[model samples]
Target chain A: MQVELQLFATLRKYAPDQPLDKGLVMNVEPPLTVSILLEKAGVPLDKVKIIMVNNRHAGFDQELAAGDRVAAFPPVAGG
Target chain B: MTERYARQLNLPHWTPETQQHLAAARVLVVGAGGLGSAVLPYLVAAGIGLTGIVEDDRVDLTNLQRQVLYDTQDIGVPKAEAASRRLAALNPDVEIRSHRTRLEPGNAAAILAGYDLVVDCTDNSAARELLNRTCLNLEKPWIHAAVSEYFGQVTTLLPGGPCWQCLSGTGAPADPPPAGILGPVAGLIGSVQATEALKQLTGTGRLLVERLLVWDALLPGWAEFSYRRNPDCWACGRG
Candidate 1:
């Protein structure tokens, strides 16, 4: 299945594993959950505070579908 | 609709009624730091009748990097007091009140009780958590914005909508971890937050009710994502 992964804020620097910033469309094996997908995309789960599967709040264990948009971002905690 | 708001009133969908709404609205900004510095000026200049500031920290030299409401001489003064003075000078038509206290559990509700709306410029999750529960119980609308490094995000939280805890997915509140941030990053996010507050107050345009708008300076673009209210969430939900 092909999915678009978005790494926001400092999460954009992930490379050598995801190898792209902002939006990246790639093909991954089926049966992917948000947590496993983050691992495969080289985005550390610790850095992510909000997860949106196709723009809605989703859990890490939520299943992914074809053409799913997975956006993960860190908590931007500065004033 | 006098000469002060002539330019904004000329804007599309803005009129005498919108000006009246702005003039009659009472907004509370919790945190006199970067975001508050920006939000206060815009809202005051545009004419929010009563603008209350809830801040207990004194100004520091290090804060001058982005807290435009303070100056070199304001380093040792309390943030809310200094901000009130500066804002009063900017527009005498607006009322500026300084709470001079932090947003703790005992005082959050009382401070918020006097205002019709709130703008969250606070830097910690614990403050946001308290605000979410309080505003939800009070049925008031609020705008939430935060910044770090080269990015920030903003959203408008209305009564019966998805709240901070729904987005956080955590029942417990934590302190905001320190992070490096550029002055402009905070300024940009605060600017957006100010816009949201004004828009929401006057009932003018589409708001970020269910949407979280992200600004990435490195990418130099705006991306929006949505989140629905969680039925089992602690703050707004029956849980």
Candidate 2:
């Protein structure tokens, strides 16, 4: 299965090679979860404060389907 | 209507009726920091009937960069008081009230009662959650916005609609270190929040409810992602 992965704010550091606006495509095995995908994509799970799967809020255990769009955002606490 | 709102009333979509709606609207802006600096001025200028500013923090030297509601001489002054004074000077026709305290669970409901809408301009997750729950319980609409670096996110949560917990879950993330931010970034998001509040109040345009609008200064573009209310969401779910 392939998923489109986008990282926001400081989470972009995890994917330094990818463009900021364009997400990368990840080919993973079946039944991939958000936590597993982040680990595979080199994003530290602790740094992610919000997760969206196909634009819907998702949990770490959320299972991703093929061609799903996933976005992870770092904690942005500043005013 | 007075000449003060003549320009807005002249707009194609707004009329004396819209101006009256604005004058009858009451809104509570929960923070007097950077985002509040942007949110309060526009609401007051738009002639909201009663604008409540809730901020417990005193002005600090480091706040002048983006907290536009204060001045260099206002250091050590309570933000709510300072913001109220400044807003009053901008539009004396609008009533400005100051709540010189934080929005904690203990007093959140009382402070939020009697307001038609709320704008969550606080920087921390705890306050955001508190506002979400209180607004949800009260069945009121609230706009949430946050800024860091060059990125900002804005969303309007209608009662019984998707909420902050639906996006981030029940746990509050630990606060990140003080990050660098451009002054205009906050101004931009704050302005967007104010626009959403106006639209919600006067029924001018489509609301941002159920959509998360993310602005990246780097991309200089907006990306909107849609979300649904979680059936199991502790804040607004049926369960």
Candidate 3:
């Protein structure tokens, strides 16, 4: 399945050649959970502020079907 | 009646009844910095009856990167006062109130008493928690937005939805890494906050509700996460 992935802040370094700072995007196996996808991408899930599936909110265990757009935000410490 | 809101009156499904509801709504926004700077003008211009701004910090040159409400001449002045002045000028028909004090548990309830809704634009977790606790008790809806560098997140909390603590939990995470935002990024999140406020105020469309809207302007895309009220949340549990 193709699940769109977005990485925030320093995590953008994972995909350096990309035009922008968003993290890498990859095609993962079927039934992707947010935690598993992040783990597969080598993103530290603990650093995430929250994850959004499509335009609605989803928890870590929420399943990602085909064509799910996933964007992850790291904790924002900046004022 | 729609003529009063003739400009936005053409915007989508919003109607005169919604405009009337907005004219009768009251909202309180904490911290007049980046998020508040972007949130205030739009809410006032949209004709929210009474909008209150509370902040104790004064403008510093460093804030110019994102705090759009203040100009060079306004530096050294209090944030709430400067913001109130500009917001008032932006829309004289809407009432603007300024409270130049830090938000603490003691005065939180009193300050939040009359407003129909609140916006949490404060930077720190401690203050954010306080606002959450206060609103949770009062059952007031609030929009929460936080930014660090290039990324930011937003969510809307109705009376029973998941709250800030439900997501962050009791023990605060260690200070996040050094993250600063591009000016437009803050503007974008703040604008979303403003739009959410308008939605809640006018009852026109579905709100962000239990979902978290996170965005990275660098990638310039949005991700949403669904959250439920934690059965054991100290602030908004099944009490």
Candidate 4:
């Protein structure tokens, strides 16, 4: 299964040499959880404060299906 | 309506009645930094009856880049006071109150209780979360905007609707890397917040409620994504 991973703000640093918005495509086995994907992508779980799956908020334990679009954002603390 | 608002009144949506509605509305803007600098002037110029600015930080030399409400002369002065003075001079018809204090859970409710609406212009997540809980508890509608470098996001959280917690959850992350924000990005998001406030107050046009509008200057475009109320959301959940 392949999933698209998008990152925003500081989390963009975790993207694998690709356009952050365009996202990176990663292949993983079935029964992938958000936490597992973040670990595989080397994005520290603590670094991601917001997770959007298919543009909807999802929890760390949420299961990911094939071809899911996941967006992760770190907390932005400036005005 | 006075001759001052004549230009806005000429617009198709804004009539003398909408001007009157603006004059009767009260709003609280929670931060006197980048976004507030842009949000305050527009809200005052549009004639919100009473505008409360809550900020505790004193202006620093570093703030002039985007906190347009202050100047080099304002460096060392409290931001709330500096902003109040400047905004008042822009429009004396609109009343401006400066609450020069940091907003926390203990004081958030009292500071926010009377306003008809709130604009969450705070830079940090803790303040944003506090405003969300307080507004939810008060049943007041508030607009939330955040800017990081060239990216910005804006959303409106009405009572019983999707909220900040529903989007980001309740936990605050440990201090992440410092954010890099461009001046115009703040201005853009702040202007959008002011526009949302006016529409919310006058009961005109579509509100951004339940929708998060994300703008990326690099992409030079906007992508709006809809979010639903989380049944387990700590702020506005059924449980």
Candidate 5:
């Protein structure tokens, strides 16, 4: 299965080669979860604030399907 | 100057009735900092009836980069006072109230009660949490915006939508206040807050309800995720 990985804010530095907003395409095995996906992208788990697959609030352990657009955001609390 | 809102009124759906709703609306802006600087002027200039400002800190030289409502000589002055003075000049027809204090548990209810809606431009976790819970109890709608570096997020929290707790399981990012902000990033997010405020008052556009709109200047695009009312939300949840 192939999934699109999007890393936002400071997390973007991890996937520097990925195009902006378009995300990176990664070939992954089945039964992949959000946590494992982030680990595969080299995005630190501690820095993750919100995780979503195809724009819905999601959990780290949630199972992923092919073509899932996964996004991770850091806490963005500044004005 | 005869037609102050001639431009906005010319928009396809804008009408005199919408302008009237805007004229009668009362809005409270918490934190007269970067985002506040961007939001207050628009609200005042757009002719909102009453605009209240809650900002306790005095302006520092450092804030001038993004807090455009203040100037060099105005650095020592209170942000609420400085911003109010500037906003008043921008449009003297509107009422601008300045509350030169932080919004806390002791004062949040009383302050928020007077306004129809609140705008969260505060940078700290405490102000965000206080505004979130207080608005819930007071039954008011609010627009939330936050920024750091090249990234920012904006959302509208209505009476029945997901409360802050549901979206922000943690009150804020675990890190401390981000010291660096690209001035335009703050301005961009605040502009969305101001636009949301106008829509909420006039019922003119599809409000950003139940959506967290995120933008990163580096990626230079917007991505939003829809969320629902968390039945287990600590504030508005059924559980």
Candidate 6:
């Protein structure tokens, strides 16, 4: 399946070396998740605060369907 | 009535009749810090009939730059109380209610039950989650906004639509960002929130529902990303 991966805040650095706006695309195995993809992409799990797939909230175990757009953000500091 | 609202009452899009709906509306602001400071005043001035402020913290010396509602002497005082005092003074016609309690899962629903709309100005993940769930359960429209050093985001969560939890997931991310915010950034975002609330209340303009409007002051641009409901989302999902 082809999944679009996005990251925000400190996690933005892990966009596979792309600019912050251009999301990363990855061909990964099926039954994938944002957490699993992060591990696959070499992201330190400790750095992420929340994960959303196609803009809906998901758990680490939530499976990714084909064409899923995954956006990840670290805990940002702001009011 | 027209004479009272003659200023905004005459805006091309918004009129005295729309301002009446605003005066009859009840709004809840869930924080009194940076975003709340920027939002609450405008809502009151715009003629919102009732306003509720839910804040558990007291003023700190460090909050002066953005928390415009409180003064130097108000430090260490309850934020809700101080804010209500100032907001009440801004518009005597509006009813201001102060909730000096934390937004916890246990009290979320009850606190928001009576309001027409909610503006989320909170600075923490836990509170944000609770507010999202409560708003979902109540089927109320809510305006969500957040800001950082030079970046800000806002969204409107309407009933039967994708909610905040559905958009981000449940629980605090293991490592959430500390609530580090610059005053101006919050001011901008909060003002947007107040604008959305007015729009939603008066039935004018499109809302940000299901779309995350992200702005970068450093980049000096704005972008909105589309979103949908996660059928399995713990809070807003069908369950």
Q: How many backbone clashes does candidate 1 have?
A: 0
lDDT for residue A74 in candidate 6, whole number 0-100: 64
Tally clashes: model 4: 1
- Candidate 5: deviation at residue B111, Å? 0.6
**Which segments of model 1 are wrong by more than 4 Å?**
A13-21, A24-26, B170-176
- DockQ of all predictions against the true structure, Cα-based: 0.55, 0.60, 0.33, 0.57, 0.56, 0.32
Instruction: Give the TM-score (0 to 1) of chain B in model 5.
Output: 0.96
Instruction: Give Cα distance to truth, residue A51, candidate 2, Å.
Output: 2.0
Give a tens-digit lDDT track for model 3, residues B44-152: 9889989998899999998887999999888998988888889888888879988889999888999999799999888887888898999889999999988877778
Q: Evaluate candidate 4 and give its CAPRI docking class based on DockQ.
A: medium
**Which residue pairs clash within candidate 4?**
B149-B180
Q: What share of the true interface contacts does candidate 4 keep?
A: 0.58
Candidate 1 structure quality by residue, lDDT tens digits, B1-239: 39989999889998888899888999999998998889999999999999999999999999999999899999899998899999999999889998988999998888899999999999987788899989988988999999988889999999978887888873232433687788888889999999999888988789998899988887677888888888988777777
Best by DockQ: 2
DockQ: the better of candidates 3 and 5: 5
lDDT for every model? 0.86, 0.88, 0.80, 0.86, 0.87, 0.80
Worst 10 residues of 4 chain A by lDDT: A12-21
Assess the local accuracy of residue B161 in candidate 1 as a C-alpha lDDT between 0 and 100: 81
Error of 4 at B40 (Å): 0.5
Better of 2 and 5 by DockQ: 2
For residues B1-239, what per-residue lDDT tens digits would candidate 4 score against the true structure? 47999988888888888999899889999998999999999999999999999999999998899999898999999998899999999999889998889998889999999799999899888888788889888999999998898888899989978888888772457755567788998999999999999999988899998888877787577777777888887667765
Please give the range of 10 consecutive residues that has the lowest summed lDDT in model 2 chain B. Answer: B167-176
True contacts kept of 2: 0.56
- Model 6 ranges off by over 4 Å: A1-7, A12-42, A49-71, A76-78, B1-4, B170-172, B175-179
